[model samples]
Target: MKRILLLCALVPFTFMTSAQNSRPNIIYILADDLGYGDVSALNKNSQIPTLHMDQLAREGMVFTDAHSSSAVCSPTRYGILTGRYNWRTRLQSGVLWSYDPPLIPESRTTVASLLKQSGYHTACIGKWHLGLGWQQGENGKVDFNKPILGGPTAIGFDYFYGITASLDIPPYFYIKNDRITATVIDSIKGATGKGFWRAGPIGNDFKHEEVLPQLTQKATDYIKEQAAGKQPFFLYYALPSPHTPILPAKEYSGRTHTNAYGDFVLMTDDMVGKVLQAVKEAGIENNTIIIFTSDNGCSPSADFKELKAAGHYPSYIFRGEKADIYEGGHHIPFIVKWPGKVKAGTTTATTICLTDFMATAAALTHRALKDNEGEDSYDLLPLLLQKGVYQRTYTIHHSIDGNFSIRNKNWKLEFAYGSGGWSAPREKAARTQQLPPVQLFDLAKDIAEKNNIAGKNQEIVKQLTHQMEIIINDGRSTPGAKQSNDVPVNYLKYR
Candidate 1:
């Protein structure tokens, strides 16, 4: 009887150990200012071949209605890592400056922190726009060489090899931890030729054009290093490609038939291929869960006119681009692949968001996260691995201008009178033409958001408004959750 009882106890322990060990390595690849229709797999009309990203989508699950929490870079990154809305933090309307202090509070729990606790090695390579504290001047001037504070390392990433902001931002250099590998002692002006870099300090070898090549190499290198390590790692590879001042390496330059933007996209595809190669070389292909996504929809400046002239619509069937509350602004290509784990050639129209990453990681690690934490994140592992079905009840979208929009089932609610965010030049001009106070669209019918049926559906308008308020007053999307008194100013928020 004693032996039998001991064996019974050991059975559960064995299952628990195996469950914990089964946690696959995670590689979260994020793109900047990429459109939903950019990938050929996502948009059949795409001219430039995104074979790598498309192969990823075809091999795994493609989330058709997925979105980013915010329609911009910094805010979206903040939401993705912490599984919390950026508005609740010190940040408000605009994005972070290159030298802005770290946006994430050390007290907050991030996906990386949770994974680290579960013995996962975490690294962030590429664009880390979430703001890193700088050794700044009393009057916005500081010792550039000083060890920067309150960045990825402090938050949870065991290794951080990326920049603090986008390429357009000043202090144009790649920061490895706190110090810049390449610096700008002299003023290196932007393509606009207006802004100037100060002469305070710069790293020895930093150059504007050198950033992309180095970053790509560093990312692949990190993957190779991690693959050889005994400890499993979580790589958040946020690429700053096909964004502003789009520049591609000589090998990829002029390689695309579209334009410079297309060429840059092809370059990004090459980067993905190289990273995937690293994964394969590591022989951990089946054990690594690889995800490729974008921060938000494409930006208006993506040479869309040029792309359209070539019979390509980067926004695809979507009506808007980045910053807009429309589908294009947040609806992005989300592909997840884990061989032998996630079913191949799968596609899920299930509405999802980057915020779900936290809860998924937490649940996978068997870490107990209170309801108040990761307020909007949902665990989708069951659906991804076990063929379980998940119906996301409600997905929220926030514009750069602080507009709030929500999609519940087939109906989408936008409370703004404007185009919501920067959709297109024509859409922006159309805002002055005509619009409703509260626009409601049955996305199943009007996927392009051409019609506003709010006047016809008063009940949904009322219900959606109430639901939006619940999220606002509670300071979170989760039921009955409220932000502490220290909640920052959420100016220009929903009416």
Candidate 2:
């Protein structure tokens, strides 16, 4: 009887261990403001060398039609973690700035929280631009002495280390698990030109040039520590590089010879290599799923003229740069590596959004999400495994200025008269010039989005417009029970 009881206990323990071991470690590397053509593997004519990212592309699947949910960082990040559109929240346009209240509600489920419930340890390192519950003093300044609230830790991450917002944003400091690493007793002057930063409060140790290297070291340390344990971990390494303050390390500066931005990109890729090395050294390479992507397309801060002069187009053949309603703004490079699961060197043209991460994780863990969770996320597992197809037919796109666009395969309909963002013939100018109220493009024939065919294809435009309204009114792009947006979304405001 004693032997039988011991065997039964051992059986359950063994089964549990087996289940845990079966789950793969997930590492999502989100590069800020990286463009499709930045990676040489994705863009053959690129002048910058992204060897590490290229290696990932060679060993895994590359998503050619992948896009951020929005043309900017904050919104895309919100969609990425929540699996819901960012516009559903009150932030209809632009990104969250420093000291902004946490965009995610305390009750909401995030990708990190969802995986944490599924027995995975989660950590978010790098930029937390989604927002934070910053306490303010009577003087209306942020209280640096108190612990922060409603941040990565509050949502789902077991551990969190990053900045309040972008590197260029003020109150420059490091945050570890809801606490500021250093007190902000000093200030720094803002700079312009190549490496620009806003004037604001800065911590003693928060040097903009050293931030990337510090983040990389922290990520590698976390990977090493997690690899020693049995529980699988998910690391969201949000890199703040090649964005602004294009301060490539001394060793990396001038290495690209193309420009400061190009040199910074090379540094970013090298940091990725270091992270990959950490995984390999930890012996978790085979059982780890590494996803490399960008929050959005390249920014104009990269100096498009300089890149073009060097015979490199950051957006490749896409029309506009970041923040535009065109393909160049949101379309990004997405590379996934899962040994033995995803075929090596494979490419998929299936359209997918960053929000899909939530559902994909659910599918990987064989868990069904509630209707209220992951409302806009569609499963990319089928596409990843190359055995099935994506259920998403039409994906909605958002511009920095809150303009809405809908893509149905090769056809795209933009509810904007002009670039909708920081491109030429801005909304005001276009309206003043009496431009059309809407723009449409057949991507198959005009991948650059140079021509507007809205009047020529009224039926297709009508169909897409109706679909966009339904997606917004239904509160989700994916099929589920009718959900509710955190706020009212009016896509017709620009129209």
Residues 1-495 of candidate 1 have per-residue lDDT tens digits of 999999999999898656644888899999888888889888888987999998897779888988898888888998899877776666655588866778888888899988998999999888888877778666777767778888888888998888767776766667787677654455553464211223323355766567777887888888888777667889998898767767767777666678777887888888888888888988888888998999988876667788888887888897788887788888888999989878899987778888888888887788977766787778888778765656358777877777778789899998677656765433345556665656799999999988989999999988987877666667667554466523644433543
Alpha carbon lDDT of each predicted model: 0.78, 0.92
lDDT of 2 at 358: 95
Kindly list the per-residue Cα lDDT of model 2 for residues 37-119, writing each as its tens digit. Answer: 99999999999989999999999999999999999999999999999999999999999998788999979999999999988
Clashing pairs in 2: none
- Weakest ten-residue segment in model 1 by summed lDDT: 193-202
Identify the candidate with maximal lDDT.
2
Residue 296's lDDT in candidate 1: 88
